[model samples]
Target: MRGSLGRRELLKGTAGSVALGLTTGARGSVSAAPEAERRRAVVIGSGFGGSITASRLARAGVPVLVLERGIRWPTGPNAETFPHMFSPDRRASWLTPRPVLTGSPPTVWRPYTGVLERVRGVGMDILCGSGVGGGSLVYHGMTIQPSAEHFTRSMPAGLDYERFDRDYYRRVESVLRPNGIPDDLLHAPEYRAVKQFHDHVAREGMAPYRVPLPIDWDFARRELRGEMKPSYTTGDVLYGVNNGGKRTVDVTYLAEAEATGRVEVATLHLVRDIARDSSGRWVVRADHITTDGTVRERKRIVTDALFLGAGSAGTTRLLVKAREKELIPDLPEAVGSNWGNNGDRIFSWTPLGDSPGALQGGPACMGVRDWDNPDGPVTVVHGPVPFPVDLGTTSVIGFGIVRPRGEFRYDPHRDDAVLHWSRSYDAELTDRIRERIRNIVGGSLADHLTNITLDTSAFDTTTFHPLGGATIGEVCDAHGRVLGQRGLYITDGALIPGSTGACNPSMTIAALAERNMDEIVAREVGKVF
Candidate 1:
């Protein structure tokens, strides 16, 4: 808000509401002008949550505006939208000179306020997406539905697990159209990481099975045949697949939503604030950022409803900041509490002496699961990994589950959503998970296998899946309707209370969003919340 061009005053409860009308400005810029209110909705952040919610609503004939803080990642042969994993460009990050990653020190670990961001918090560094497609741009394509038992453990009470599995999860999968790693591709040399792990685990008396991935295998086969530039073959999973094989949100929900012509996707529009106007409509303030990272225009949207689907960090931070700034009173005390790393950790495993091949694949596909162990409740899953720097050696990343939650605090001076977590936050739980990883390595690998290395040693503090804050039955009702606030809803990963068992959290996140939209649409059209 420091450089924003608008009235700084927010909607105080006692004060009358204020409206800013649209006006032509510098370089053909425009501002908000209150007009006849329509039954319009605004969904913030275009990840799985935002995409699904916006798409379904538009399908139901509701005019929707989707505000995404990140740029629209391009596709096709001429598209150079993403950065290389090895030589990461500054554009790979959000307004930073370099890619902000795990093990970042204090100077780089700044509390985030910009709605468009790639941020890290103390002991819990998070890598969230900042583009139209959200984290789908950077995440491993692995998707799994958590076991009903473990899913219930992390989930807040009153969520009917059986119904979700039977209806919601199935509904999401029907659209996602996930497929197991192809039989032919797994035999390829490029997929040595997966094949070797699968074989090794089976030898260890564990029945390792193929996991479902959100990638289009048909396109991958075309790449393997040298008909096009490689995406999966080149290990372009983390930074994004430039060749367009990945079935990201852009290719699915967003594309379908745009086809309806009733939805508008505003990319690079940083949603700065949300408050109520006098008439009880929602005010959405978005900073229109150009390619050069300059704020070109301050655009505000007046809508009948607003959905905070800006992932866990973005949504939590925005709501917390709104409360702290007094823009919204009665913002729940649980707004920033019960958040955690999802027991996510990254450590390496390499062959004892032999070259572990290129150690490059589609970033992730196969992971070792030991969920049946009586010693602990953790899953040490591996991914199709890489040597990032091309060190000629292999590095396999292990993601383990540990159930510890953290909270977000609003710092007015910095105008940041600060997360306070320590390495020792859940020592015992972390140890249990790590030891399981060690056991998997020790019991499975041979003498030549090198033990897992510490690398930054801060690996345990980072999380790709940051869950909670504005969670169910806490900051919001079980249906994601914010308590004490009407005409507002939440549909994103933040609705997840904590971990999603040993699986990647995206599938569960989307499933929950699907269920949220079903309820929201019914309530909006007729049924009450």
Candidate 2:
């Protein structure tokens, strides 16, 4: 069988994919059953949840094995690993044979597996990421934390808002080092779009409105000076940033985990199932996929403890099937319930007259928080499309206090989780986003929506932030421990009972992971340590 994590390629020029900003670790590639791995803890899916948990576990001297389904994104000497947004190559998708298009027309585009992974649910078309860094590889590096009041509706009752706001948020910031684009750069010619929205929000008297991101400031400056190629300004985040401009988890958390000499990160290890053996230990079944999307071997890994950090869609699908097959029959009734799309509305405005519209300016740099009514809440963040749209196209993405919840139940015929949803579930949020656009750009020709694109399925929209399934106070305990199963925990966005109230959920996911690890370490692995 072929190697799993691409360790064999480390000696070649492709090693940068696995260890982006790390200083240590043997950094072995994934091998299919080269030998059985027995760890104190086995963490599945290396996104925000798995990355932070593995880092904490390794630091505490617990042996950890992190299984990531996608292959490594090795940056060549010229940063060739990450393809440009307009010209996405094989590295862009998770397992598709080509770059799959989700937004607007040109429905069936190219044919190459790149970073953005498309999971076609029965009622929805889900977009997720693959690779060692997981979602971090493809998402905009925004770290917007929701106000404590926004956390009232969902999540565990009587949560310690003080601890989360002060301690956990700071913990995430300490690692991510997010900062607002300097005010000096705000009015610069290259940052016109960023400056434009900043002024709009400021003039509209929006509360706590600003763009905070984890982009490399110096790298952006170089790119602005034409010394570097397009990273953020030219739609770099849409695919994956080829330059060292975006600081994702692989460079930060996973690197720290490897430095401890107690963690082994194995990419291409797609976790498939979980079952309890005779001795009550956990047995994890997985597919060790190669770089070419070939399954080299089916590996069954045994561990003392297991974590379901794959993500909302990923973890929910796995657990729901496991329950139906009686692998973990004691799973709770809320296993596949309380899921949402963050009330997302993906609409764009292309001005009527011929004017050089703004193109991609890296990650989302500004947001408007004016529409948050205690009665009905919503937050709209203005983002750029950065490309052929330069002639006028711009993205209008919104996150509302949407409470419409959907559920995922295993479909025997399809052998996948089918989401129960409808077009009417998003009508309220969509109308709110339209009003936000009108208010923010009232005088501009963009006040009225033009060149709109709708999901053909049900005129439904898409969202990168899919939250809840096996959530806290429901599927898992307040501390993220699954009720029916001990040693099996969830520490991802799946644990967030609802939307993050107009802000991006990455920081909250990381902070909650930090909070959960504090509990998991003290209780579950203290004896082993």
Error of 2 at 40 (Å): 1.9
TM for candidate 2 is 0.87
**Candidate 1 C-alpha lDDT tens digits along 387-421:** 54444344444444555468888765556677777
| TM-score against truth, every candidate | 0.87, 0.87
lDDT (C-alpha) at residue 155 in model 2: 48
Local accuracy of candidate 2 as per-residue lDDT tens digits, 221-325: 777778767666655567677777667898889989999999988876766566665566677766565565555665667787899888888888877766765
Show where candidate 1 strays beyond 4 Å.
1-8, 11-39, 77-79, 102-117, 388-401, 444-450, 453-460, 526-529
**Candidate 1 C-alpha error for residue 188, in Å:** 1.2
Weakest 10 consecutive residues of candidate 2 by summed lDDT: 17-26
Candidate 1 overall lDDT versus native: 0.68
**lDDT, candidates in the order shown:** 0.68, 0.68
Give the clashing pairs for model 1: 21-32, 21-33, 22-32, 22-33, 70-130, 70-131, 339-406, 343-402, 352-448, 352-449
Q: Per-residue error at 448 for model 2, in Å?
A: 4.8
